[model samples]
Structure formats: structure tokens, C-alpha cells
Target: MIQETYPMTVGGEEVLSERELLAGVEDGLMMDSTDSVRYIILHCSATRCDRDYTVEQLLHDHRARGFRTIGYHFYVRRDGTVSQHRRLLEVGAHCRPFNRCSIGVCYEGGLDAEGHPADTLTPEQTDRLERLLLKLLRTFPKAQLRGHRDMPGSVPKACPCLDCRNVFRAIL
Candidate 1:
């Protein structure tokens, strides 16, 4: 799936952009600074119980929650297609202390029957994650990959269960 273009349910082919980000829906608060991203924190969105929604729907929901913009920098679909969320080069609204220096990536559908993040990475999703991260590293060479738990206080809540170190070991 590491191709020049990606097929989308968004209706047509979306050429992967070398551009760091898109113009956010909000002009002020939504726009964060583009400092080099030092970390890539992975999270398992807890809404696995009942989510037939898309990344666009999730962003809309965040807007209603009063977010000036989307939270994560990228949203990985169950289908393995990644959608641009907030500006990757821009500070994100994902982590608290590290939000300004980290890039957040949200992968859909991993929670288990107990509502915990399943300790497994879907084959397709992992492959895409690897390819995308590799591409990002070329631009942000110093970026380090970590799980949501690795953040100063992110402390596990079921995410990146795939031995994160092994996942990004090659990139680092």
C-alpha cells in the first residue's frame, strides 16, 4: 500500500501530500506552531464499542466538544488508509505537556470486549503505520516514536499494544 496515491472512501484518489498540513477549519486557536516534532504518541480511541464512524465524523465530534481543531495529527482507518487530521508539522492538541512537541496518531478499532485496547495491531494497520512513519521521519528526522503511555504522564490506557519499541525500532 505504499504507493504514490491512496484510494479513499472520501470518494476519490487522494494523492499523498508532501505538504506538512492542511488549512484548518479554524484560523486562530486551531493553528498551532510548526516546531520539529520530537515524539509520535500512539493512542487507541476508546470508542470501540459502537463506532461505525469515520475520521471526519470524529473531528466533527471534537469540534462540538469546543476544540478549535482536530486533536491528533493523523487518523488511521481500519481499512489502513490514513487521513490527515491536524497539521503534522504544527503543534497538536493530543497530549497535555507534550502536545506542543509531539505528533499524535490515532488508529481506529482496537478495544477489546472489556473495553481495553486490544494488545494486537491489525496487519494492514501496522504496515501502513510503518510506511507512513518512515516517510515522516525523512522530513522530521529527529522525531522519536512512543506510545501514549510513554509521554511524561500519558500512563497507559490501552494503546500501541504492539511493543511500540519494536514497531518503530527500524525508524529510530
Candidate 2:
């Protein structure tokens, strides 16, 4: 059962609720046990913030990388629409080594126009992400929230490009 409501505004135009955005998610796979979940890792597409990319494009990109499907469990578009790429139960390819115990969530932008790492999350995306994270936390009560860069042995990269631990500290 869902434990909370996520009401969000995207692009200063449309409003969507958590239920609305996640309504179409299929029960594609089931985790062996929620106990195995240790972290909810956040990521960014690394695309320019001004562009709108779809989940299909990300899937194709992942496929090119030899992944059978998109590497993330969830993908948040620039417009704040959330799409399910892989099921929560499936091991993701977003972060190495931690795949078996982590859930990956990718947002659309992490780059500025000059191609430098930046926190380019749209207001809508930010709002929706907060809600989504909260919901995931409720579902997996033991999981800790983390940024992709926060993982041990990760390369020097600003993935998710935001201090997710500080940003969501209240909820955590």
C-alpha cells in the first residue's frame, strides 16, 4: 500500500501526483527479498538540462552498452514525468559492485550548456524526486539514500550532481 501523496508541478505547467505518475508501472519483477536492498542510489543522465529525453532513448543507449535494458529502475524526465525502466527486483547496471543491493534512479540532466557538471534539476523534477525518494524509503525502510558518487571505489564524477544525502537528510 502506498503511504504518501506526491503532488508536483512540472515545467510550471502540469501538476502530477505520485500515484498518477506511477500508475502504469507493471509488476515486472519481484525482489528475492526487500532485506537485500541496502541503498537507493541517485544518478543523472548527464544530458544538457535544456533538452528533453525520453526513457526509450535511454533504453537504446543502455542497449548499445550491451545492457539488455535500461540500467535504472526509474527515470525522471525533464518534465518531471517518472518512467519505470527496469523493475525494482532486477539488479541494475547504473553502479558497479553495488548492483545487487541498490536501486538506481536517474534524472534527465546533469550538464549545463557548456557541458560542465551542474545541478540542473528542474523544479518539477526536484519536487517529484523528493516524493519518489520518500516513497521508496517507505517501501524499503532499511535502505539508505545515496548519490552515485558516494559509493566506495566510484570514479571521480559528479553523478546525480547534487548532494543527495544532504538534500534528503530530513527524510533519511
Candidate 3:
């Protein structure tokens, strides 16, 4: 049977809390004993809207690109199922230079049917993203939210493919 509950790691151990699992993180994952998180960056999978993708697939893609693991800390699927990819305490490969101080959360789909990059977040994806961001904000209270493309020196690309600032305005 398909697993109904997602699994999350807290202090390197698995926890079954649905909210934490669905948020794609646990408390300790976002912070280290000496590390302070400064930003939560949003990204997109850059996949066509008509298909569904998984964190495992993303892991393989990242590995193929020479990354040791999936770069994003969290992966939100089209159906709103959230999956944890990388350990939050580890620096991500999702963004350059700023990776050391940021958490990367990516949602599946940033391309339209015609294969052009677009804001392809489904309603379910949007709702889940909001909830996940809110939960993360509770942990990193002072952290700012930003789209992947908003980072300084970031190449010109609509990584998140949405107005992430406006989408998360109420919480930020």
C-alpha cells in the first residue's frame, strides 16, 4: 500500500507527526546547535504541469548533475504530499554563495503544457506550500522568505515561477 503518512527526521531519528511530516521537516532539521538560519528560499521542479514527479527522481537528477544529494530541504508534490529530501542543517546546493545560510523548499512543476516555464503550481500545491512555509517560519522566526531567482548573483530564471513575495506576504 502507498504510505499515507510521510516520515520526517528529527535529530536524525524518524518522527511520525503528520504536520511535521507534511511540512517536510522537523524542528532540529532546520537549525544546528551553532547555526542560525537566515532565509527560506522557494524553488520549482521545472517539470511540465501535466506530469507528476517525486523526491527520489529529483535526487537522481541532482546526483547526475554532480550533487551529492537532492539539494532542496523539502519537496512538495502536485498532490500536496510533502517529502523531505536533504537534511536541513546541511548547506544546500540549490543556491550558490548563499547556500550556507538558507533552506531550500521546492515544489513540483514550473512549466506549462507547451513546455515553456510558467507558474504551474496546482491549487493543492499552493495550499500545502503556504502551510509548510508557515510552519517553517515558526521555527526560524526571523528568517526571510524569497524566491530562488531573487538571490543576488542568481542567474536569470523563474525558478519558483510565481510571485512568491506576494504569495507569502501575509506571513512574511
lDDT of 2 by residue, 53-148 (tens): 788788788766656568789999888999887776777777877787889999999999888899998889888899999998888877999999
**Lowest summed lDDT over 10 consecutive residues: which window, candidate 3?**
20-29
- TM-scores, all candidates, are 0.71, 0.79, 0.77
Mark the regions of model 1 whose C-alpha exceeds 4 Å error after superposition: 1-35, 49-51
Q: Deviation in angstroms for 85 in model 3?
A: 1.4
| lDDT value, residue 112 of candidate 1 | 61
Rank the models by lDDT, top first.
2, 3, 1
Better of 1 and 2 by lDDT: 2
Q: All models: lDDT?
A: 0.64, 0.78, 0.77
Ranking by TM-score: 2, 3, 1
- Over 1-172, each residue of candidate 3 has an lDDT whose tens digit, in order, gives 4446546455566645554343333223344532477889999998999987777789888766655468788999999999987675776668776676788899999999987889888889888899999888777776789998888878747788888999878776
After superposition, the stretches of candidate 2 with alpha carbons farther than 4 Å from their true spots are 1-31
Q: Candidate 1 on 109-143: residue-level lDDT in tens? A: 66665666665456787789888877776666667
Error of 2 at 168 (Å): 2.3
TM-score of 2: 0.79
In angstroms, what RMSD does candidate 1 have relative to the true structure? 11.5
Going through the candidates in the order shown, the clash numbers are: 0, 0, 0
